[model samples]
Target: MMIKWFMLLFTGFAGGLAVGCGFVAFLSVLGIIPRLMQLTKTIKWIRLYEWAVILGAVSGGWFSLSPVYLHASHYWFIPIGLLYGIFVGMLAAALTEVLNVFPILAKRIGIDDKIVMLMMAIVLGKICGSLFHWLYFAGL
Candidate 1:
């Protein structure tokens, strides 16, 4: 039980960090922020975004696995949960971009780009998290 919780926590955190950083990097590549600012100053509010992503992933994973976890071996559900989390994150980012509903901080930073890259990162993160969960279940 404790191990499962720890795995979930770590998976969520790592997934969040990876996706958040990847998205920021993608924006930078598109010249969203000035080069000087991108290289020199640490982005403000990035930590907040990371935490948000982590929490969102964890919650999504937990909720998705609730039924399976309760009835069967909780371990088997980990991978599926993680995969579901990745899909949720990706979908959420894509929908937000489509609707132009990103947090105000994103606009404040002037991160103008294709917007599709952000969506891709989110989806990829969720996939990675799910894969990780699968690996854990396989004891790899």
Candidate 2:
């Protein structure tokens, strides 16, 4: 029994570490942080950005997996939701930028001249979907 519990704990820790390392490696290979810094002209704040990413991942993981909950007011969720949206948007933008996905997609689809419109539509769709999800699900 003791050995079984130890093995379970070790396996869980090792699996988590492997997944975490792969996630960080993916972001690094995609050059998301560096590209973001370059685009924003905030290269000097690279360390700050790196630390923010690390802290955010750690705190987010803890908050998500732990049974503890903060009984914050509904108003507090506004800023939290905004931050989540910004993070997701940045990640999606980084992925698209790294792969030149939008341009290639537009050219392939013969919408080269309407690339901006395509992007705007995607953004609007994301916003509307997110809003609908929260509004509809919150009632449940």
Best by TM-score: 2
Per-residue lDDT over 10-120 for candidate 1, one digit per residue giving the tens place of the 0 to 100 score: 998998789778866654554433332344354675676458656875676678758654567767676876676755554455445444565443566666554556556
Over the stretch 4-76, how does candidate 2's per-residue lDDT look in tens digits? 9999999989988998999889878888888877766889997899899889888878888899877899889
Pairs of residues clashing in candidate 1: 82-130, 83-130, 86-126
Using all chains and alpha carbons, the TM-scores for the candidates as numbered come to: 0.30, 0.92
What TM-score should be assigned to candidate 2?
0.92
Worst 10 residues of 2 by lDDT: 32-41
Model 2 spans with C-alpha error above 4 angstroms: none
Model 1: how far is 28 from its true place, Å? 37
Model 1 segments beyond 4 Å from truth? Answer: 1-105
Error of 2 at 78 (Å): 0.8
